[model samples]
Target chain A: MNTSKTQKHRADLLVSCVHDRAPDLIPALEAEVKRRGLEGEVKVVEAGCRGFCSMGPVLLIQPDGTFYVNVQPADVPEMVEETLVKGRVVERMTYQEPSSHACALYEDISFYSKQHRIVLRNCGMLNPASVEEYIAVGGYEAVGKALFDMTPEGVIEEVKKAGLRGRGGAGFAAARKWETGRKAEGDIKYVLANGDEGDPNCFMDRALMEADPHSILEGMIIGAYAMDAHQGYIYIPYEHTLSVKTMRNAIESARAYGLIGEDILGSGFDFEVEVRVGAHSFVGGESTALMHAIEGTVSEPRPKHIHTTEVGLWGKPTCLNNVKTWNLVPEIIGKGAEWFASIGTEKSTGTQVFSLAGKINNVGLAEVPMGTTIRELIFDVGGGIPNGREFKAIQIGGPSGGAVPASLLDMPMDYETLEEAGSMMGTGGVVVLDDRSCVIDVARYFLDFLKDQSCGKCSSCREGIRYMLEMLTNITEGKGKMSDLEVLERMGKSVKISSMCGLGKSVPNPVLSTLRHFRDEYVAHIEDHKCPAGVCKALIEHYINDQCNGCGLCLRKCPQDAITGEKKELHTIDAEKCIQCGVCFDVCRFDAVGVR
Target chain B: MPKLKSLDELKKLREQLQGDIKARTDSSTTITVGMGTCGIAAGARETMHAILAELESRGMDTHVTTVGCIGMCSKEPLVDIQQGDEPRVTYGNVNTEMVPRMIEEHLVQGNMVDEWVVGRVEG
Candidate 1:
């Protein structure tokens, strides 16, 4: 029996979600741990996002798996005195299910139990700032295997066998791009990790980047070896300060450990990676546009008639993968292609991490198998819609991605299925809409966001989005002509074909897809001159109902000061003073604010 | 944090680092203390200090943690010791003087102080 053990610390307190809204908790935990002279027995580690954003700032005691939710500095001493000193569980601090009213262990939580974790495996498990913590959990082992045990051709062949596709919206075959870059004629080739996550509702890449930057680094290292590229760049948006900082720290740690730089792990393969801050615009997600940005130009998409795999960045052959794509590399190499292929669907293998938001309970990052149904993700994983509201539609992908109504809740999600439903699996940013959501207004909202971020390089995209926004606005404000609908469809087709890049091409997806599935919402807004969901401020009117019961709550909370009420009398809204901000509708505890 | 030279060395380093993050890889027997307001008021804090001091003096590393109130306010300063796969035993009204004997008999000697035991929680 080889019993060489060095279990020095009795309890390792791994704090999840420090980068989120939670305040500084470790310092207080550390100070209390020391006061008891149990420093040798207790250790506090600031881990990365656990993907459980709803119960953020949670503290997990490893070995025991005692997870404490909503941990504050004030709770540290009692926790230390109880759990750290005496090894008793604090029931009040543990995670309690919203509906079940039952406490659960970290792994027992349905949000985590129902899903499979790959990219997030190392996220909340280690100190991302430390290379040793990464290694302790089998971090760089794949890089070592690729560097010494596998040949360049072998690496690419394994990836090809795995059937991994680019996760950055395109679903382009990842290994084929590596093959192109490998065979491309150039002495100076490059591999780029696209960290410019521009999707508004998505933070999957940021979570991985800030939490497990080493995973991306290791993946890029394997890619560089496969492509025989000497240098690479991780292009992050400047706004994700934590991602930039953690990635830089990971690279530095990798360098100091000799896992990066010349002759890594005693192998002759040489590679280095540097972070290139890029424009955070949606257009920058395009490979060519990102290449241009890396070359110190404006992030504008150019025609991809000539593939960037042949010639990119400074006229050199370049291989670019999303930060998520890079993140999956080391796993495929270490765990074998067959293991990865065994998961998800046959074609779209492996898991995808989705950032859940918008009118949904338990909004956070979830990594589910490729073919998970929309129902499972919403009800089982996301804890269904908030306030017991009926889920109206579950929007997959992002702004450029289309909306899938509740009628197709059981549709299994994959690249082919989502695209067939008129939505591309664009970066897995899921936004669930309740019955209160108007699909027309939803389309208008996305088009509005895209309109702001559109590079304006292509007239079809620029003018198409402008025209769509105008028509959408007209329909919402009860000014739409029936002919406007036909023109919208015709113009949408023209825009789809004439657009130069994805940003332009997918600009019409929102309008076209919503029209395909939910035409009645648009008809109601146009034919009946009624905002069915009471969303369009121009069409809807608000008034206090008889159920108000003299509640002064809305009066005090109303931003516009349009509500008037005595101490014990029903409130009345000054219609002229009401700006239709909907604050009254949201704040009314008695559901007294009526909208039409 | 020495620069690793080869894959074999990296493997060796992993085994060593695995020990560093032991709580991450494996679960072990644990010791629990109730630090509820009632427990603390009944001298649970001093009891914890004694437990830690006794273990520290003996150069022992144990998995000691805390819990909230267990609804036994009269039986405050409750301390429970659990070995692997064994039913957890709770001692009631524990004082600082009882810590050394508890650690010696329950933890080191693999025997419970049955006379002072108030409850048994079977896994």
Candidate 2:
């Protein structure tokens, strides 16, 4: 370290460094620091995901807790010179609130302020690759406490009193499953950590695994000890290579530290963990299918007549929990059950991590209490919809989950409440939709997704999903009858009841929920042969309004050359040749293009 | 590092590690400079160097670090001085000339340069 000739420097400058996809800003920052000869005076450290991905590459200065967004390489010199050398803040780089016009600090920004980060407490705060950093923040204290202070029975009872449910999708009580696994008559028992997150547009598990790998390991160890499981498996999808690598490293580090492997912490408890990578299949995330895959068999779901807690992973008692669910165990043990139960609603205790994305200003991961309203998640924390668009609906859960209309925005976001509102809190993926989004089109999109992912174990799921897709496609293409609605409702209900696993059962949620909320849009498409949102291609027609200044930008973009007219005059679309592609509507600067 | 043998050992290690991190990051008086794109364009680099040189000569243990932009683009080159748990005082349109006075008043004498303060971070 080059000593600063004047005095020994102590302050460290931390930057939000990006290695994948986004441009790496660390090189420029380092170059500027060196050019100024302030290497030893100011230490530059790279931190992990700052949660505000949209505004990245972000930079946060610690000790004072100042945050900057949308940083470019060219700006590094001035930042280094002024902030590092002179201790003066760059006013332009400071965050200015859109509404209040006040310069917002890191803690004051609504995106960071509105969050209740229980699961994501360590994320974006520490260097994820360093286990020492994790330990410094009180990481494995729970595992130590569980080993020394709490008995196996005591741990289970505390979790039961905490009311922590499975965060994966089903919302089943975690302690209940552990008790079943403990009581089952088996010579060998196993604890399986479900990192196989296959939900569309959901990445809370991926973020948790990447940011804090040891949390999951600590939780698994506690769960393994509580259930008397000697062996464990962490099953992650192949697509999540980062999570898999991080988990593997964490396990090895824990072993080296004697926190895992035989006689952990001198407690005489023997538990070994192995990482299992699986193909990215939507149905593979199902409990039984995951167990089969782990046992080196074809990944397929069997009938759930017998619970996995009794018979799982090659005919042995197994306790399977989601990654987020396992991450919560350590916290519940560290902080007592009553403390955990005090948060969230009466039934749903602890916070839920939601991947808030689509049609929102701030798109990233958010962890809020169970009772946090949809309005708070979308408006307050999300910074509302971008470009001042009105929020139409929010799709909670993944593609298999339902969409709730804006009218029910105040509904509390808990497992039971969301289920009652025609949506399950499956994997905590809240996708917001705006007014321009078509309800029928949204239902068709999810149906198409489910139809492709459906495993052909049960005819009800395989054929039922296909039939529903065909019906939704017909409605969008202006080829639907009034009686098709009744058929769709009947088919959806049957599929929900007769499907073998969670994947097939909840497949019709998108269709059912959209149909229940936006039936008028369906009625308009079928009865009047018109798409209300002007989304369905076959049912809608494009026309040039009087507002057209005849820019000819649309004429150049039209593939079929359906538009006609000279420059600087109102253009016309020939009805016979027009494809109704809506390219003109998107390209028009003066709002000249109209769809009906 | 040796393996933490017991719960008491683990707890003691955590306390020592936290203390080291807290000493560097959570000192009584911390000065943060906003060094986002807008701040650099406004010549915040000169202001920063001036403050650092002043602190070095004075031999004060005051903590100073550079932070990303806080989105106040119109007011480029901002400085925030926070002492202990009190509200953070933000000074805007900061330059090299303002650095010595601000450090002397805020860091040495424990008095804020009132006119230069643009905003205060309230709890």
Q: Residue-wise lDDT of candidate 2 within A374-474, one digit each (tens)?
A: 99999888889987778999998998889999999999999999898889999898888897778889888988888878888899999998899999999
Consecutive 10-residue window with the lowest summed lDDT within model 2 chain A: A1-10
Which lDDT tens digits does candidate 2 get at residues B1-123?
476677777666665455323313445666677777788789776677787778767755566666767789888798888787789899999999989898888877888889988898873
What does candidate 1's lDDT look like per residue over A1-596, in tens digits? 11134345656889988755655687788899899887766788998888888787888887677888888888888988777765577788988775686563777777888889998888888898999888887889999999888999999999999999999998899999999999999899999999988888899998899889999999999999999899999999899899999999999989998899988888877889999886688888888889989999988878888888898988899999998899999999999999999999999999988899998888899999999999999889888888878888867789889899889999999999999999879999998889888888988999999999889988899989999999999999899988888899999999999999988888898898888888888888888898878888888889998998886988998888899989778889998998888988888889999997
lDDT of 1 at B115: 89
The C-alpha stretches of model 2 lying farther than 4 A from their native spots are A1-17, A88-104, B19-123
DockQ of each: 0.30, 0.19
Report how far off residue A398 is in candidate 1 (Å): 1.0
Q: After TM-score superposition, what is the CA distance of residue A96 in candidate 2 from its true location, in Å?
A: 5.8
lDDT of 2: 0.83
For each of the candidates, what fraction of the native contacts does it recover?
Answer: 0.50, 0.25
| Candidate 1: residue A560 Cα off by (Å) | 4.0
